[model samples]
Target: MTADRDLGSEARQMLAERTADLQAAEAANEALRRANAELRASRAALAASEARLRLALGAARMANWEWDPIADVVTGSEGREALYGRPPGSMRSAPEVLAAVHPEDRERCAATIRRAMERMPGEEEFDAVEFRVLHPDGSIRWLRSQGRITDRDPLTGRALRAAGVTFDITQRREAETRYRVLFDASPFAVIVIDQATFRILDVNTRACRDYGYSREEFLSLLITDIDVLGDEAAIRARGRAHKTGERTQEFEAVHRTRDGALRDVLVRVEGLDLGNGRVTYGAHIDITARKAAEVELRRSEERLRVALEAGGLGAWELDFSRRRTRWDARLAAILGRERVDAEVANEVLSRCLEPADLPAVQEAFRQAMATGGDFAAEFRILRPDGEHRWVRCWGRLLPDQHPGHRRMAGVVADVTEHRQAEERQLLFMREMDHRAKNILAVVQAALRLTPRHDADSYAAMVEGRVSALARAHTLLAENRWTGADLAALLRAELQPFLTAAPEAPEATRILLEGPALTVAPQSTQALGMALHELATNAMKYGALSTAGGHVALGWEVTGEALRLRWEERGGPPLAGPPPASGFGTRVIEATLERQLGGTVRRDWRPEGLVVEAMLPIGTIRAR
Candidate 1:
């Protein structure tokens, strides 16, 4: 029984050991199954991800390419080959791909790749550098190449693979070229500035040449340097406009040139927000010459105004369409009215004219307008002070280019002094001629009255009288036949003999008195000769002989006649009124009779000599 029991125990132990081993084996098998299932799932997921990547690449028209620098082999999508302008399967080697690169850009592309490999072996890199490639059809297209370093082979010290996307940007590049041609060739000067730095970013050839600066130099300058406002104001304003997206309009200001000279310019500034930041564009038009011309025209107008005022001429303009009349300040002042209300029309202006003169003035204006020619009229204006003044109106009507807006403009001048002078000249000519005839008759009479044996004395007296008459005419001519002052006349004709010698006359010997008055031309001539004759006689033998002798001269204007009284006191003795009919005495009588149309009396009194003359006021008034 013990042997049997021992055998069973040995069998059971072996069976248990076998069972444990089986369980361990099953566990190991189950774990292996799970790992196999996980591996399958991972493979499926990877396949799905690759499919999605291909779809995305196709949708985006993007091509993936790999380049192995060591093996010189390139692997890429069909689209990549298309972008490279190469035949399908043609870019299997680096050399094959490089063969399509433009000759001009081959060096640049090689250099960029070399630098990228040295800097970043297994890291990604990208660049938008422009490159050219030969098309499959023998044409050339511009392209923007982009790439990444995918892997590096450690054993070869070379690129294992580089992945990149290349897009055909030929149309974009062509459009840019077309736009650049237009932008550079525009007539208007255009500039673009970086808002942040206020630095000039881009300028065309015209802008550079206009500013007298080179393109590189212009890009280095700040916007404020050439800005119309200049300095900080320009910077601040440009910043504000850029931030607000505002479009500035024409503003007149000055800009500084490269040489620091200021030029008047009209500027229009605009802001462009380009998502990344801001840019400012400006257009400039030089207005310096136009401004100078406007200034010169204003100065010329001012000079003309000064000349008109100095000449005392009044200017006016009439607007026929509006029935309005415009007058300058001087014109208003001449008409004795305030300047502000001077633009009134014909109604008010007509009231300023005399009743008879108003008709003549209206006729003149009508004729001027009808003929489009010059018209002149002399008329009288009734002043506010109840006085009449002679006015000469001269005008020229200009034909209007506008159908209904013809007008007349002209000047008005006061001709009172001029008219009076004309009248005086006419009267003096007639009177002087009449006096010459009368004087000749007197000479004839004197010659007849003198004895035949006294021919020499008679000739002397006639000659002296004619010379005195001539002297009077010379004095009248100096005054333009207008008039002569009494004091000036006396001094001119008598002062020479009164102070002929160094000895001064007695204090009481000469007397002269009168208020300031203008004597007529006729009166001047007549009185001048009479006074000259009297002075000559007095210096010869009358009141001027000694210190005790005295002469008195007085004159008065009374209505129609001017009365003159000459008295002599304490002469050499009592002079009996020029006992002989000498030249001096005859001249005095003739002047008073003919020129003055008055009488002269000579008194031979025991008390020296006395002479008095009375003349008509009208005759003297013509002076």
Candidate 2:
């Protein structure tokens, strides 16, 4: 049984060995099948990945690329080949790539590639760069390359190859350049600033020129640094408005220049949401001249005020648009107003003028405005308190002076006292002239009644005659009589002398020549008495002794003299010197001497007696 068992065991052992070998072979076959399945899956995935990559490159207008740094081999995509004006698979080495790159940028591209390779192996970083490529056809192409280190040796941890993509970006680069140029050369001043800090982020050339700050200097500064408004409150308010996303419209503000000058600017500010916070974009329009004009206007107003005060004159303005009148304090006071309302109308101002004088005042004002002429009006004002006072108003026109606005303003004055004083002075001068004439007439009359003597007596006689003449003047002035007629004066003075010669009046020859002339009171009294004495003497001895005898008496002002002449022809022979100087002769001599300041000569000739008197032209009377 052992032998048979041994034999059976041996057979079983051999069978078992065979079964084990078969099982082992089957297991190995199953392992190979699993490896084959995995290989097939990997191959499928790789094909799909390659297809997807190709589709993506085509969609982006790009081509795939590779580089073997260790071998200095370069492989480019179809797009890269096209960029170099060559067919696909044309680039075979780094030297070829260098040839394709522009000569100016070739070395720089190599350097950049070297730097990329040095850092690539462990976890390559994606990088992008731009360079110009030259083609065999002599054309230049702009290219953008995006790449990463894909094939690296794990053991050495070194980049063996790099994979990237290339695209033709010539048109895009040109567009970018044009946009930059336009932004730089724009006319409006543009500036970008960080909203929170108000720090300048960017500024255009126009902004730099307008603000008088360089780009570097402006970027370092805050908006407040350039804002000329020194008030901190206003700056803070503007900052708050910026943060609230409000679109600031045009606003006028002052800006400080590099030279420390102030500039007026109109600013438009807009907020930009940059994902982190807000930034401000501003456009500035310089209006410095306008601001200066405003300041000048204010100064002009101040000057006007000073002028009015210095001239002691009042000022007034009328605004037709506002329907108001602005009357200065002095002008209101002249109208007896305690409280003045500038809002009053023209009618109210006119009411202050006297009613009877209103038409003249209105006419003057109308003419002044119509012709743009200087205005002057004198009128009485009816004060609020019922007192009537004179006022003189003067004005000048200012036309087309206010730009974009119509306005007129001028000064007025209260000249009542001045006008009144002038009138009073004229009246006083006239009275003085009358008084002086009266005094001269009185002296002439007083002199005519005195006796002839030496220079001293003559002076005394002239004075006394003047006194008597003054008395006569007083009578004339009492009646306001200007003068006496020739007939009236003769009749009044010769009445006493003619008492006995009533019938023999014709015997006396008194021949008066020339036109009748009137004489004032003093002249009449003095000359009348002298003439009466001469007539009486003629009647007694000179020419009136015989009816046939005749006497001639004539008076005239010829050239420069008041002359009187008396001649007798048929009377008794010429008489010798008188026994004494009679009152009549003295009166005649004094009359000629004092009143006419003249010489009288009496001569006794063979035929008759002749008397002639000559007076100065200055003392001659005017009719």
Candidate 3:
């Protein structure tokens, strides 16, 4: 029985142990199943992550690549061939990849790769290169590659593999080229400067030419160096203000060139934010000529002002389209009106004009406007003070490119003095005509009244009378037909008799005493004829017939009449008045009494002859 009980115990122990083994096996199987499920889940997550990476690379125009130096082969993502402008699998080998590189860049690319593969200890195994690739279609593409050694031989320390990313940079490069072209081709001088330092960073071709500096030289200068004022601190402050939008971008400043020539420039600045810092782009436009023109224009205007003031000219303008009239202060003074900003109505101007002159002035302006010609008018204007003035105006149309917008500008001047002079001249001419007629009538009367003796004697008498009248007429004309001087008339009529006695001086032969008085034109003629007759008779038969004879002619104003006397001495005696009424005696009496309204008397004295006359002052004196 003990032997049998021990056997059961052993069996049970073995069974329990087997049961424990079985349970452990089942637990091990469950762990294996959970591990498998976790792995599958991890794989799916990894695949999705890879898909996201590929999508990002594609969007960025990038491709992952691997290079095997030992095998001389290359591999990459699906679109890696496109970056090199090649078909899929065409650039699988290193040599094929090299052949696709542009001839200009192949050697450089190979050198870069060789350098990266030979990286020494303690040195970075990374490399970057930008190169071009040419395609079969005669097109080229630009690419950038960045890589690091992925695997290397431990003993040889040589690169076995490299991996990196490549991307298309053609668009970026083309944009840079276009910007460069435009920058160099700008018409206005352009410069790029660093905002912080005010240093010139870059300059275009125009900037170099305008500043009289080379591109390299300009790049070395500070912006303040070109400022003629050279206020560095203020300029820097302004630049800071511009960056902060505290000041306007455009300003005028004088800039100096390399040759020290100053230019008036209008500068316009634009701020560019380049992430690293702010830079300024400046454009300079030279306005030196325009500034000079403005100065000259001001000088010209000043000169015009001076000339107008000196000439007593009033400037005026009329704008027909706007119905506005503008005039300078002088014009307002001329029109006797208070100052106004602009004359708005034609009626206002018309009120200052004489009613009779307004129509003609209006017609002149109308004709000028119709023909686009000049306007000129002379008219009488009534001032506010009730003073009448004559004025002349001249105007011309201003040139205009647009129709119906004509403007006329001109000058006006007061011509009252000129008009008065013209009227006086006309009156004087008429007076001269009347005087000539009177003179002709007197000559006719003398010819008719003279007696007819022998033909030669009669002609001589007529010529003598006519000559006397001519002398009187000449004296009247000299005085503008106003009057003749009495002393001058006496001297002229007695000149022949006084000079006939050459042995005796004129003072010894003749005496003239009279106060200076202007005789009327009519009285001068009558007295001149009477004196001629008496002097002729004296020469022929009285005092002048002898050399020792003398004559005294004198006049004085007494009350309202003038009394004149003629006396001859030291000559053969005149027995009495002529025996009969003679032509010379009658001429003297008729001229003095009938023409001058005066009385004449003769005395026959033993020594010589005497004559006396009395006339009303009104008839003898010049009025």
Candidate 4:
């Protein structure tokens, strides 16, 4: 039994050993498969990385190169060979590559190369340098070369061979230069401000000059400090508004300079999004003169509106170059037509002109154009309603020096009412002249009525009476003979006596007072004569002949009647009433009673004389 157990155990052990061998072999095969897969993945990764590198180089139009210090040879890739203007591998040595450097840049390039080769400990691994290189086509290109040591001396830590990339940076440099030129030379002021602090970040050349600040000084200031119209809080608000918004804004603001002068500017602000925060780009354009002009224009327009309305005028302009006419709305109304457009063709306006006066109008226009002169004429224009209306036309030529291209600006007025008024005035003058002639004839007849036996007294009376009539006529003429101010009439008649003492104040020696009363032309002469008689009596024998004597004459209106009183004082006494009416008294009674349609009454007092007159107010014509 021991022998059988031993043999079975040995068989089991043998089978276990064989199974373990097979498992080891399977483990080895799986490990080998994994290694193969890893190798393939690494190859794929390297290919992808190389492809990416090639794509980057192509995008940047850059070239890779290797320089060997020992061999003194410079090797370039297919792309670098193209930059050198040669076929691949045409450049054989470092000196050949260096030969392509521009003469002005060759030394600098060599110095850079030497410095890079002498890399010191703790220095940056990468170095970048820029230089100009002359291509085979005789064109110079700005090249930027960046490199690090690919092979170095172990003991000295010095670069033995270097590998780097080169790119044609000509376009970039040109773009940078163009930006600088535009930013520095623009006419309008430009500014950049930081969004968070509202502090000025940058300013252009114009900004420096316009704000009266140096570039360094301006950059140190907050935006609000330069704003004459706003404070810090407002500037902060403006900054906030620009930061969170995408739309641009335009505003008017007053900017103050370092010299404390204020300038009106129109500012246009827009957001500039950057990595740090929102930056504000602002443009300031001056509009001070334009603002003043606009204000003046508004005031002038207002004045023109008032004048047109007050004088019943209409403004017109003709642009001869375009043969276009423009007129105010009032022009159409004055022509008795529907309001026309402010601008219209010339023929449309010329259609209204009358042929009789058209020649004068045309001549005026021609003269203005030829001589750059003023045009003025009275013409007639028929309205659409078929009524002829007289119009006074006036104009002036603009662009005075250039007659060929000019505008005719003018005023037009309807003169029908004025012309009719003038005609009426002429007719009235003729009537007044006829009436004056009749008055003279009446005076001649009255002179014949005077007693010839008292020749000296008759001549004196005739002269005084004629003068009184003449005085009345003058007063009426002064008013254009419309009527006379009753007060003025009395003053005129009493002028000789009232001012007899020039040293005395006016109207004090012989005081006169009355309500404003304008007597009609028919009554003015008669009333003036009556007052003259009374004044003559006072001067000859009554109040005016004595010192400290006066005559008080006054009138008031009541119940459509004028109650007037004349009181003489401080003069010779009247012992009794006149035995009968004298020439002067008779003249006063006749003139006042018949011509003025009034009555006169005389009272004989002990110390002086008093006269009361009743005149109808309706006849006096108080206007």
Give the lowest summed-lDDT range of ten residues in model 3.
239-248
Tens-digit per-residue lDDT, 362-477, candidate 2 = 78867876786877878898887888887767776556656444345666667777776777557546754765775565455445644566879668546544443444444445
Candidate 1 lDDT trough over 10 residues, lowest sum: 497-506
Candidate 3: tens digits of C-alpha lDDT, residues 242-283? 553543387778899999999998888888889999998889
Ten-residue region with minimum lDDT total, candidate 4: 238-247
**Per-prediction tally of clashes:** 4, 3, 0, 0
User: Which 10 successive residues of model 2 have the least lDDT summed?
Assistant: 493-502
Q: Which model scores highest in lDDT?
A: 3
- Which of the predicted structures, 2 or 3, would earn the higher lDDT when compared with the native? 3
TM-scores, in order shown? 0.70, 0.50, 0.56, 0.62
Q: Using lDDT, rank the candidates from best to worst.
A: 3, 4, 1, 2
What clash pairs does model 3 have?
none
lDDT agreement with native, every candidate:
0.75, 0.71, 0.85, 0.82
* Alpha carbon RMSD to native, model 3: 11.0
Measured on C-alpha atoms, candidate 2 has an lDDT of 0.71
Q: Would you list the clashing residue pairs of candidate 4?
A: none
